[model samples]
Target: MPKQMNFIVSKNSFEEFGMMVILGTTGAAMETQMNFFFTFWGIFQLKKGYKPGVAGMPFPFKKLGGAMFRKMLKGFGYDDMWEMVKDGVEEGKIKLYPCSMTMDLMRVKKKQLREICEEPVGAAAFLEMCDNADAVISL
Candidate 1:
């Protein structure tokens, strides 16, 4: 009976998608309940020890492009969605999960994701959370 819901975002945008996730989650936290399941392209941003460009390529052939894109974000004052989600967690009304299967496929270890994620769960488990949600969105 949560007032709000869970969102599943699977696309990779030029940080635009990332923007939406941050906005949506922040909105939910302010007014309703919320959870986010990051899968596929979404998982790239959820990696624990993962730093966007300092590590490996989160996106294919877009390393330099991605870095420059993030620099642009700095000017916009775009905040890190992961850290925002963490704040939501500390406030006790949010949960963020990094898809377990996606991690395996990408060769991303659990230890690598634990730092930022509330937990690493399967899609089905995530759907279970969605079941009672007022909305379940995939972007």
Candidate 2:
């Protein structure tokens, strides 16, 4: 059997989400099963119409640099991070799950999430899913 991979997303930043999409898609393309678990602020990324911008930089430069970086990516013919993630889902290369606890704490409804979110699961459930995974990555 092929390897199963699990990713935990805890940050609500563009860089983190972007890396998740990249790895998720690439892993699936490589014939691995990939699952993404979104928690905490990361749940925001699963929200409908959420746009990820560059994060993790010091103030002032983060916003400006993010916009410039996105523009550069566009010029290079790369789809925006959200589009990439959606495409990954559409291609059956990614499975998305929002953390149930985070959803409850944030008062987020299922309808508020993008169609890509398969379901909401608790931390224990998430761990169970990862128990047999060949690799588990946290972002």
Candidate 3:
């Protein structure tokens, strides 16, 4: 059987989230089954029309720096984060799930989430899915 990988995403920063997409897609390309569970601030990434922006820099200049950093990344031939995520989904390379507990706590409606999100599940359920995974990574 192929390997299974589970990724837990709790950060909303662009760089961190982008890495998750990159790793997940790459794992899929390697014939691994990749599952991503988005929780806490990470759930925002699954919001409808959410755009990727650089974050996690010093407070005063985080937004500005992020924009410049993203522009620089584009110049280097990187696709927009959202586009990369969509591509992965289209290729049947990923399964995306939103954290049900976070959804309830944050009052995020299912309809407000992007179509790419397969379902909303609690931490217990997410852990169960990862139980047999060859590797479970948190980011």
Candidate 4:
């Protein structure tokens, strides 16, 4: 596990958020260090009190999908996304890095982010982090 595991997230819709958690936690169980670099729409996932929903789904089916998604999570023996995020960070398996460039471009303040997030990182810093990564995935 010498490879630095990093996930470059670009969205935070229901599916996107779920996938990121699945991948991040998988790395968590592996005991390999992991990073989640949230950018663009993904940045909101780290914003304080933000609740991800099935926004990408059509209006009518969104409510159904969201209910099903929550049920699926419970079936998998997990609570909420934020709980997993907090656990992962506390366990030192995952670090949340919200893109500073995105934050600036979007006029987001550091205080607007979740307390679990590390200091905002710029593009160059993010690239430097990924320079040692085994794989850099975008979603």
Candidate 5:
């Protein structure tokens, strides 16, 4: 059996702070030998039409407000979180799989997701992969 690493996320947007951290951390971990699994809101980061906004933030920053915050964050030189995931994928260490159940519930189309998703897979398949994983994390 292949060694495995599993992560399950159910947060919507970037609000699920824990999942966001996992996204970035797991992306870095991609350099190692592992497969990452994304479920529910965890898949939001990969949504092609999704856009980040501060509307739901405590301060409710809108439009340019969110843009300015992003600019400030990017001054650190790293692209936004999703871009880092892309880099990991390019290195052949990352495999992005959106949960089939989540996709059906949320009505997210395959074309709506970024190029990272191998395919929308069922929970049973995800668990099959997770069973082989050396570790599993659910956020």
Candidate 6:
């Protein structure tokens, strides 16, 4: 079985976050501990009522792209992203942490984030948590 794995999520794109979730949950199924840290643009999608959009699409095309992306994911039998995260948390194998500094700098409040995320933590605290992780992947 794998040991602790840490993920530094720095983007809020479908490709990055979606793939991370897949790998993280696969590891979790093997009883690996998964720690995900959301920072910068990554933290925004963790908020409630957030709709995911394809990264780097023209403003007018983003909505359409997101729709197409969701359809593709659904074809692959994947549930909504938030639902998957909630499942991982409820299964007790994954923990999500939002960067406190990111939130502060972006003027985002803790209450705005989903409850599945743990209490926000600074980069130092997150680094400490990663000290023993077998792998640290940045996405």
Q: Tens digit of lDDT per residue, candidate 1, span 71-118?
A: 786688867655656676766677677888888877877776646467
How high is the lDDT of residue 1 in model 3?
A: 78
Whose lDDT is higher: candidate 1's or candidate 2's? 2
What is each predicted model's overall lDDT from 0 to 1?
0.66, 0.83, 0.82, 0.83, 0.64, 0.83
- Encode model 6's per-residue lDDT on 1-139: one tens digit a residue: 4599999988777666676679777877889889999999889868888766777788877768877888898999988767776777898789999999999987889999988889999989999988888889898
Candidate 4 structure lDDT: 0.83
lDDT by residue (16-99, candidate 2, tens digit) is 876887788788778788899999899998888776667877776776766777788789887866777677688776889999
Q: Candidate 2, residue 12: CA error in Å?
A: 0.5
Backbone clashes in candidate 3 total 0
TM-score of each: 0.71, 0.88, 0.89, 0.88, 0.72, 0.90
Cα RMSD for predicted model 1: 4.3
Identify the superior model by TM-score, candidate 3 or candidate 5.
Answer: 3
Better of 4 and 5 by lDDT: 4
> What C-alpha lDDT, on a 0 to 100 scale, does residue 11 get in candidate 4?
79
Using TM-score, rank the candidates from best to worst: 6, 3, 2, 4, 5, 1
Q: lDDT by residue for model 5 over 1-139, one digit each (tens)?
A: 3345666666544444324434544655744434556676666756885655554655556445556666776796647766666666776666777888888888888888888668788889988977667778765
Report the number of the highest-TM-score candidate: 6
Tell me the TM-score of model 3: 0.89
Model 5, which residues run further than 4 Å from truth? 1-3, 15-30, 53-56, 62-69
Off-target runs (Cα >4 Å) in candidate 2 are none
How many clashes in each structure?
0, 0, 0, 0, 1, 0
Candidate 1 at 70: error in angstroms? 3.5
Question: What is the C-alpha lDDT profile of model 3 across 1-139, one tens digit per residue?
Answer: 7898888888777776778878977887888888899898889878887655566667777667767877887898888767777777777778899999999887889999988888799879988987789989888
lDDT of 4 by residue, 2-114 (tens): 44688888876777788878878778888778898999999988888776779778878875786788898899898787787678789988899999889987788999998
